[model samples]
Target chain A: MPIDRDDARRVAHLARIRVDEEDLPALASEFNAILGFIEQLREVDVRDVEPMTSVTPMRLKRREDRIAGGGIAEKVLANAPDAREGYFVVPKVVE
Target chain B: MDGLNSLSISEARDRLRVGEITSMELTQACLAAVEEAAALNAVVHPTPDLAHEQAKAADARLAAGQAPAMCGIPVGIKDLFCTEGVPSQAASGILAGFKPAYESTVTSRLFEAGAVMTGKLNMDEFAMGSSTETSVYGNTVNPWKSGDTELTPGGSSGGSAAAVAADLCLGATGTDTGGSIRQPAAFTGITGVKPTYGRVSRWGIIAFASSLDQAGPMTKSVRDAAIMLEAMSGHDPKDSTSADIPVPNFEGILTGEVRGKTVGIPKEYRMEGMPEAIDELWASGRSMLEDAGATLVDISLPHTKVALPAYYVVAPAEASSNLARYDGVRYGHRATLAQGDDITAMYERTRAEGFGDEVKRRVMIGTYVLSAGFYDAYYNHARKVRALIKKDFEDVFAEGVDAILTPATPSAAFPLGQKFDDPVQMYLNDVFTVTVNLAGLPGISVPAGLDPDGLPLGLQLIGKPWEEGELLDFALAIEDRAGFVAKPKRWW
Candidate 1:
């Protein structure tokens, strides 16, 4: 389906990426082109085929749920744009 | 022989053992080369002090006769691989000042094997674009060129390819997600291998599409690729998907013998509008493999046409989910917020300002596909088709095809900005390469021959899963038969 300007706006919002009002049409057209190209996938008969999540046939490796490797708070917050008293400081949502 | 930086990894290892050349000398030579080729914009972070320190350590190990094969070798680490305390931006604006406190598994393994790091190389933003033009550092120029037109080093591993081709480093690490490594290697006239999906650990490499991303080596020769790959690969407990298989001695077992191996030539890859040079190169590749006592069989990967579209859907869908972690809170470039702005506004502004156009397009597409209304039709359907694509490879390999041979790319390196305007045109660059990623198989692009414009073209050899040893051996055969010794003219 061809994506409209509203659809592009919705997608950008859903993606949490702010697209300018001017760029929405361009984004919509690009999405439409990609969706149009991807429409070709409907031609293949995928009846009874299982969706492949990974190339290998292995379950997610599980281990004992314990704190295995996270002690250095300084290292963890080394690249943080905003940190306060060894904790990441984000905008206050509850306020 | 020509210079310490020009020697292949194996040759450097030999010289290091025989006391002919020290690791410090080789690392210094590569550092000098990196300085001389600054115009190429290959090495993004030239860690001279760290490299010299590692080289000295390697020399000490070699003196004690305890050095591994990669001991003292100077290799360029792709920026995708996070080096502890070094900036590991996936060449994106959002990751502008982000530095990881932990090292990636692959680079850590390379470091453990005594490989000296020259610096982090440039790549496409989040390893998305094929031209490396989307990088914040700017487009890495292909060392090869026509009269005066500068060409692009195919990306997102463009910097890796350029550095190796220009002799800036002995070898460099590259991550292949939908032909990032192979296409760049072909463009720069070097050898690159994309190991099977689970071959290399992806612990610290910035995630692009977790299922499609695999790290490999870009080198001057297949033998060098083998040595580098061996050092870079092994199962890591951290990466749950990393294959728990024994790492084979890839360089030692390269006898260049492909006798009794059935090489498959897929009819589906013979796409229309393919340049005559690529076709000729493919034909010659078939002949060369046949001459190596391998039987060439016509095979069919019937679902090949849908691979690209499916890959686009799947890769972006996963990328959207993976990149969600890059919000303003934890790390990376956080957008300055206005008064009374909440977390959601911060996320929107941060992502809007951080990601490039191509990345935004992908994330939007990914979100659209995974949205409530279109999830089953787009993302789920694409995943099912991806299974069929994998089945197509499985069927051919089940029929005893040891490896599949095809053209690595549709054409040689194009001039920069020629295809930048059209994203579809740029996406076509990975047409011949994306199928391997979809099927989760190992693929290598070896410099086959030159095109009419005197640019290098590459032939791809796709191997069965977890069979990179055989894949590299067959690539060595092609490298031997093709005898591709041409290097890009030192324009930089």
Candidate 2:
């Protein structure tokens, strides 16, 4: 199915990317092209085929649910765009 | 003696051990070559002082009678691999000015093996594009050219391939999520191998698609690839997916003997509209292996045609989720927020301003597929198709096919800006390569021959999972018989 401009805007919003109103047409067209190509997968008979997530047959290695590492707040926050008082400073979430 | 920059890792290792050359001399030669080839736009960040210091340390180790295989060798670390305090962007503006306090596991392992880091090399932004055009540092030109018609070094590991082909470094680290390593190696006429999915640790390398991403080596020759891969691979407790199996001595196991090996040529790969030169190169590659005492057989992978579609769906889906961590809050680039803007607005603006066109396109596709209404049709179906694709390879291997051979790329390096307009056309560059990634198998692209246009053409060899040693042995046979020693002349 060809994605429309509204669909492109919704996807951009869902992905947390702000798409300008003017660019939605171009974005919609690009999405349509890619999805049109991807539509070919529907033709394959995937009856009873288990979806493969990990290529190898190994379970996720689990460990004790205990905190083993941390406490270097400065190093952790080194790359943050805005960090103050050992925490990331983001725009106010509360009204 | 020829310049140290031009020597292979194995050759340089031998030279360093025999005291014929010091690591400092080799490092200087490479540094000079990097300076001379500045027009290539290959090395994004040159770490000359770190390289010199590492070289001195390597020399001291050699003096004390301790020499690892990679001792004193200067290699380029792709920009994706984080080096402590070095700006490790995946060639994306979103990662602008983000320097990691910790080094990636692969680079640290290479350093442990006494390798010197020459610099951070360029790559496709977030390892996304097939050509280096997506790189924020600018496109890395292919060292091989067709008479002044500048070409792309295929990415997302384009800089690693270009540097190795141009001899700026002995070998460079490369990551192959889809065709990043193999395609660029083919375009630049070098050797690159993407080892089994968990063979190399993905601990510190920025995640694109966690399931498909793998790190490997881009080098001048097959032997160099083997040596470097041995150093770059090992199980890390830090990476849960890293295999618990012991690392093999890949270089030592190179018997160059594919005798009695049954090499399969998948009938499906003979796609319609394939270039005549690619067909010729594939036939000649088969004969070379046959002459080296391996038997060739015809096989079928019926799902081959659908692998690309499945990959586009799965890769983008995964990328969307992985990239969600890059909001304005934690790290990397953030957009200026006007007063009264909320957190959600900040996130949207930061991501919108930070990501490039291609990345945004992928993120959009990803979110569309995974959205509430369409997840089952696109994302779930693509995962099942991926299973079928993997089973196709497994059935062939179970039938005693030692490896599968095919053209590394549909064609050699095309002129830059040729395929940028159409995304599907650019995606087709990974047609011959995406299956290996989908199946999580080891695949190597060996420089097999030159096309009639005097550009390099490569032959890909896909091996059983975690069997890179055997794959490299087959590649060595092809490399030896093909006798492809042509190098691009110094035009840059």
Candidate 3:
């Protein structure tokens, strides 16, 4: 579970955040600190406690399963740096 | 003066109804103010032509005898929201060039109500910092202090708060995940409200912990808060989480009488190393309620200690999942690699270069908490603690307490980089405000008074999920009695 410079480098690659080699040490250190914090939770007694997904303690409201969405597609896509064919245009992934 | 920049939403509506101040004039005044405050660095992108074009249409509607409550009001949309045609980045490199073809429902609703968006205000990238310092664009400085270089307006909705506080815009939209809206409002000494989650649709607002993300209005007055909330709240078919309750007259219900309300003064909020002025200001705020015929009741939110840690766990965990879409292929800045580069390498290179250290720190924390070996230990347990925190509020509310009051932040806005060194300490700035978010309740931060350093101290009010009416009434009553008038000198 320990994250070294290599692991941090991999994470940086995954997250699309550009971190230089010099910065990888700091990122690794930060990752270790976070892992250390997570380790502290190991001491808590939570065997019987139920995981809470929401605070309201209410059942999820049920709606009839149906496709109903409203909003202009042009208005939605207006912020995209590149858009074509009514979808976000990205570099060709498949040759 | 164009009514849009200076007039309250109600006044603006009245003018629109009677044809007094034209929407175009109002929109122009806001554009002019944005130009004047360019040095404030409040607005990241100004869409003056778009705003004016919208304003012209609104004016035509009014001239044709159409009456919209928000007709002609120029507002600032925090850059976190995606505005079609305008760039929508979460103020981070990963989302740098990513634009949503869709408008966030909240801002679009505001536009539908005739509020012209003047520009996109700056925010901490992905709403991830207390000081707005995490913004890739740049850190936002407070408008309250005149000529002080390092004074922060607060974050990650710092620019939204600054624009409203500096009178650059009539009202600005803010999204609160963990104290983003109210903390910035407090720092700027403005009136900002974070409605109960789902009260406003999050359909178009960029996600920041889906459960906690909410779009609210930051205005200069409580009345404006009401009018704006009415315009902002509604059931959006796009946002499945959007509430279906009918929006209330937030303005009309301001009877300003807190006669029978039992306000809770939680003891746990008073911690060690707390300042004397904060106690004095809190006491003064309480006394104001007592004078207004409300009883000050002592309450115990016993699990208050766990709110911050739980929030740190839950928010970041969700953030890790929510932010995963920003790989190089779909949207945002793509770090360069050779042709036929593996997809995984592209993601790694792009994310590593795209996010800043604080953001990286958060993503790391988020990933760690949700990772295979730690999910049950970290995220699951924190969620249980979250339940306890919610129970504390429920028990107190069941005991006849209408609202709870606490200092919005542990301290007034600290030096620019004061808490940056210690990330945990920086996260603790959200301690007082996070519980409300955890409880899925409504809370607001009103400027209470000044600390010893003359920085603004804000008092937070926690209310029942749907009882903002009672809460705002109580806040206004206290605001009246406290006579806390510390306006920003930069404005004058």
Candidate 4:
């Protein structure tokens, strides 16, 4: 399917990226070109073929469901843009 | 350039063993070379202090009669692999100034084996682009320049290729999602191997497409690749997907004997409108293998044409999911928000200001494909197609085909601005190498010959899953016969 400007805007929003209104056409065109290339997959016969979830055949490795690590809250908060009292500070979410 | 800096890992290791050279001297030579070649922009974050400390420790280890194969060798760590307190930006503005508290498993293993880190190397932002032009540090110049025209060292492992080819470092770490290591290695006249899926631990490497991403070595020769890959491979418990298989002594098994080995040349790789030089290179590569006593056969892999399309869908889909962690709150770059901006606006603005054009385009594509209305059509269908591509390789391997040989890239290194504007045309550079990534097979790019312009061209050898040692043996056979010793004259 061809992605229109509106679709590009919506995709940018979905990806949490802000796309300027004027650049939407260029973004949409790029998306269309990529999609047009991949659209050739429509001809690939995939009947009875399972979607490859993992490249290697291995089960999800499970460990004990407990707190195995952590306690270094300082290190965790080291690279945060804004932090106070061992918590990341973000813009106000709740009024 | 006539110093220890030009020595390969095997040569340097032998010298270190006999006490003919110290790791400190070798590292200093490389550091001096790196300083002189700043025009290449290959080393993004030069850790001279760390390199000296590591070299001192390595020299002590060498003197104490404790030596690993990689002991006292200076290698470049790709920016994608997080080294403790060092910039591990993945060459993306989104990760600007970000440094992890821990080292990546591969780097840690290399360090444990006494491999000294020269610095963090440049790469495409998020390992997304074919050329290193998408890098935050700008594109790494290919050492092999065709006349005065500057060429790209194909990426996202471009810096690793450049550093190895230019003798700035003996060997460098590289990551391959879709031909990142192999393509750059091919363009720069070096050796690169993308090991079988789960063969090398991916822990602490910045995720691009988790299922498709792999770490490998970019070096001067296949022997160096084997030695470095042995140090880089292991089962890391931290990485759940890391295989529990035993690590083999890859360098010890180099017989260079391909006698009676059945090598297949897939007919699908002979694409329409292929450059004549690449075709001639492929033919000459077959002769080299034949002369080395390997039997060649023509094979069919019908799904080859669709592999590129399937890769675009799956890789972008995974990239979108993997990159979601780069919010404005936790780490890396955060946009300067105006007053009254909400949390959602913070996320949108930070991502917009941080990511490059190519990264945003990929993220947009990924979001569209995985969106609710199109998930089944684009994402799931591509996964199913990926299954078919993997099966194509499996069938060929089952038919007694030990390995497959093909051109590493369609053409030699192009000028910097040649294919950057067209994404589709740029993606085609990986046509011959992507299938190996899709099928989770080990693939190596060995420098085979030079194009008419005197630029290097490499031939790729694809091997069975977890059979990297065997693959290296075959590559050694080609390396012995091809004798590709031409190096780009120093211009930097």
> DockQ (Cα-based) per candidate?
0.84, 0.89, 0.38, 0.91
- Clash pairs for candidate 1: none
- The reply for model 3, stretches above 4 Å from the true place, is A1-22, A32-47, A57-95, B1-4, B15-18, B64-66, B146-149
Write model 3 residue lDDT over B1-492, tens digit each, in one string. Answer: 333576666667787788777888877877887887876788988899899899888888788776567777889999999887788887887787666776788888888988898999988889998888888888877877634646778899999998887777889999899999999998888878888877888887778799888888898777788889888998876777777889898888887699988999999999898878888888988888889999998999987777777788898888888888767655677778778766666777777778777877777777767777778778888888877778789899998899998888877777777777777777778878888888889998888788877778889999988898888998888778767767676542
Per DockQ, the best of the predicted structures is 4
lDDT of 2 at A81: 93
Question: What lDDT tens digits, residue by residue, belong to model 2 across residues B274-391?
Answer: 9899999999999999899999999999999999999999999999999999897778999999988888999999999899889988887888889898999999999999999999
Model 1 C-alpha lDDT per residue in residues A1-95, reported as the tens digit of each score:
57799999999999999988998998899888888888999898888989987787777777798888778998888788999998899988785
lDDT of 1 by residue, B65-107 (tens): 9689999999999999999878889999899888888899999
**Isolated chain B TM-score per model:** 0.99, 0.99, 0.96, 0.99
lDDT by candidate, in order shown: 0.92, 0.94, 0.81, 0.93
Clashes per prediction? 0, 0, 29, 0
Candidate closer to the true structure by lDDT (higher is better), 1 or 3: 1
The C-alpha stretches of model 2 lying farther than 4 A from their native spots are A64-66
When summed lDDT is taken over every stretch of 10 residues in candidate 1 chain B, the lowest stretch is: B1-10
Tell me candidate 4's fraction of native contacts, as a decimal between 0 and 1.
Answer: 0.97
How close is every model to the real structure, measured as TM-score? 0.99, 0.99, 0.92, 0.99
